[model samples]
Target: MQDMLVRLLDLPDVSEEENKLFEKEGVVFKKPITPEKSIVVDWVGEHFSKNWADEALAAFASLPVNCFIAQREQEILGFACFESTAKNFFGPTGVLPHERGKGLGKILLIKSLRALKEMGYNYAVIGGVGPTSYYEKVVSAKIIEKSERGIYKNLLKHSK
Candidate 1:
């Protein structure tokens, strides 16, 4: 998989509209505090992958903790994190399978990207991208040429 680049300054302002939709569905977007770290990590592990959970753990330790969550009356529906696997990286985001298409993913993504922009980043690298069209449509992300395998080249594999 190739990496993609997003010009943070060119991102569209969709948080406001997305927030309204989220509020209507009783979903709240927020950054996890110290006490909520374990809860968020556990949820990510269960709903996404252990790899993402590990990345979320790293995000929790960052200077400003570049991660966000979507919850409704206490249950986590989605999460997005940046500067976890690497600095100026936006990734490891996912929404629960059952909760897909509710716009939670987009909201979480925009919120996280906005945070990156606020952190003085002019661009963000969406490393090892999965859904190319989705990222392109949402943030105008462009593929970094000849970047197949990007930073995951030496990733270890488990033996069966």
Candidate 2:
């Protein structure tokens, strides 16, 4: 899949929708604290992949931390990270398979993109997108022309 670009300035207001999910599902959203890093990484590794876990670790190294997570009653349900795979980049996000229909992924995505905007970025790149339709519908993201593989053009795969 190709990478997508999000114009941060044109993002729709997500607070109301996010708050509704929070109230109805009791899910909380926030950046993982230093003490929660290892737990978050381990969760990502188990549910997603080790590579994404490593990127989450890099996000923690940033001053304000570039990752956001969704949890309910102290159990993580999903996560999203930016400025990990690349600067002004949003991704490596995933929601638990069981929680797919809820708005958790949307919350995590917009929260991270908003964070990037607050960091002075007018636009954010979502590298190597998987759910293209989701991004397009939620943030009006558009695919970057001829950017299939994009920054991961020469990515090395692990030998099994």
Q: Distance from true position, residue 10, model 1, in Å?
A: 2.5
Displacement of residue 148 (Cα, Å) in model 1 is 1.5
Residue by residue across 41-154, what tens digits does model 2's lDDT show? 999988988888889999999877889999998899999999998899998899999999888888889899989999999999999987699999999999999998588888
Models 1 onward score TM values of 0.93, 0.95
Model 2, position 125, has a per-residue lDDT of 97
Question: lDDT for model 2, on a 0 to 1 scale?
Answer: 0.90
Model 2: ten consecutive residues of lowest lDDT: 151-160
Query: Candidate 1: TM-score?
Result: 0.93
Tens-digit lDDT track of model 1 for 1-74: 88999998877777676778676888888888888889999898877777788899999897667899988998
Best by lDDT: 2
Backbone N/Cα/C clashes per model: 0, 0
